[model samples]
Target: MSRKQYSKELKLELVKKHLEDEISYWKLGKEYGIEASIIRRWGHKYETFGEDGLEKQNADLCNYSAEFKKKIVLEYLGGNITSQDLAAKYKIHAPSTVRTWIKQYNNHEDLTNSRKEGVYLMAKNGARKNTTLEERINIVEECINTGCNYASTANKYGCSYGQVYVWVRKYKDKGIEGLYDRRGKNKAISQLSDIEKLKAENRLLKAQTQQQQMEIDFLKKLDEIERR
Candidate 1:
């Protein structure tokens, strides 16, 4: 026998009774011919994301296979499939992620180069950088000119808003010397010189390390298979 699809209102109404302890779940499930879990889900959703979660029936959610998704995206990036065609084929939860992956693949060389030279130093956390306080002052001024506010610049630079604000004032009056992060202020961000650069480089290195490990493990497995 096929299961019947009940409307959201009926589910919510049943959930209300369950919450009140007005009826046993077994009796309620038998009465409505729905699973006990469905009733429990309504209660859990109410506790978490709240009533809006009530509208989502599991069937509405997508369940694309990860391997299939990667294959389709890679083929599309190679010009073997159209964007709309791929979208229809694999019901991606967010198609934009595919586009981003393709963009990253295309820019891999530039990204790799950026990671190697100390140009990637912004991504490193507590390392000492040769770039002086003057350069930081100039970047902060450029950031402000580009309409970056104190908070955003702080988050980007991985420094406190207080530090960025003081630097901005110093850069305004005394120039680069004024913006020089006072030592002992945030020994970390100050020592590193460019917190954002350091963070980005470290992130890239971690990703590369993981990828290298996976490749090494795969090669080792392949060698063992060939010997067999």
Candidate 2:
């Protein structure tokens, strides 16, 4: 699926809920139907630069000079910050923008007027995840056999909690083939029949709701202790 863009106002609102209310990112992601990683990135931006950090950015703005892109890429390679961090710091439109620049630099291609090679760099330094197809199938099967228990499945397999959740959902929607990465691209939801899309969304909402309940229970315990 193509990346979804959020407005500046929405970003600020979510950040406020995350910071001022002390809500967990995963819960917020469930409530708002956004990825928890995106919420964490917004929190990072808000902490580093305040309101201005949440400003809406678009690549079409063309505000970044070639020199600026080169500088950002160099700093990123220097290990000062991640692509997400650099995007937050510079108010770049997307973290992928910096990733594109970094990919170009690493590939010995020109940074200026460069394009992404359609690789999904989920980690820093353009590292491709080494999770084998067998591993992915195992993870999804385990998650299912465990009643979609993402945390336990992740722990058992040394996978991220979010990764397990995503894998399970994709497996449900498209069978085992859905677990493939497809190199930074996926079949867009628009291509799905209306009923299929609705079913997928309903499944996501149910999983997210369960996660939120767990977080709430944990927070309540913490609150009781604080009041003691």
Candidate 3:
């Protein structure tokens, strides 16, 4: 899906929420229509320039250039600007260039931005995430594209392999709503009880097999004595 942009008022409101500790960075990004990570950029905007961070920003922070990428990013952040709108203004060929720039801004400092477990910035400040299913469809596609096995995908997403398959397969069949965890909606599908029952049955079967093997061994010993 294409990204949505935020207005000046909206940006300021989200920043207020961040400063107030009322909304987490990730949630604020969702509310303001920016990526969760971009809160870091907003925070940097606040830290370097104070309240001016919420203003319609312009210019670059890294090279000390007055021509900040902020204005272009701000428009795109509103989530309405089309890829064509972006290419013309930013003189970039790809819409994803704008996305990469925003990601850069987000890792800047906005500590208020929320992150999941195992996501960290490398030396280059680029991110590597230990996948969680915040966006189930997207994550499942990633796993498929990467050719990872289901168990591996489960490990990455903090779910069981069975769950990864279930969510992804449901999304493939039914679309986004299918990704909403149904574990709460139906206990029968939750599998915990079923798994426990199977475990109990398996224990009983194993004990029966062990007893039969002991009997067989005893009979073999008796036969040996008879032969002797």
Query: Highest TM-score among the candidates is held by which one?
Result: 2
User: Candidate 3 residues 1-228, lDDT tens each?
Assistant: 975556656665666566444478888777756787777676544433333234553432122122345665556555567546786665553454454455434324121222232232121122223332244555565444333234334444554343444455565555444555544543222344656545533543454455456556645744654555
120-194 per-residue lDDT for model 1 (tens digits)? 112233122333454565446544532334433443565433344445555456543454455634323335456
Runs off by more than 4 Å, candidate 2? 1-38, 41-129, 184-228
**Per-residue alpha-carbon lDDT of model 2 for 1-228, expressed as tens digits?**
988889988987887676445689999999999999998887655543334446664323335667888999888766557789998899887786687566555534454532243211122221223475556766766655444545445555654454665577676777645666656364543455778656655554565565456556645744654555
Query: What's the distance in Å from true for residue 116, model 1?
Result: 32
Model 2 weakest lDDT span, ten residues long: 119-128
Rank candidates by TM-score, best first: 2, 1, 3
Question: lDDT (CA) for every model shown?
Answer: 0.48, 0.61, 0.47
- Scanning candidate 1 in windows of ten residues, the lowest lDDT window is 109-118
**TM-scores for every predicted model:** 0.24, 0.29, 0.24
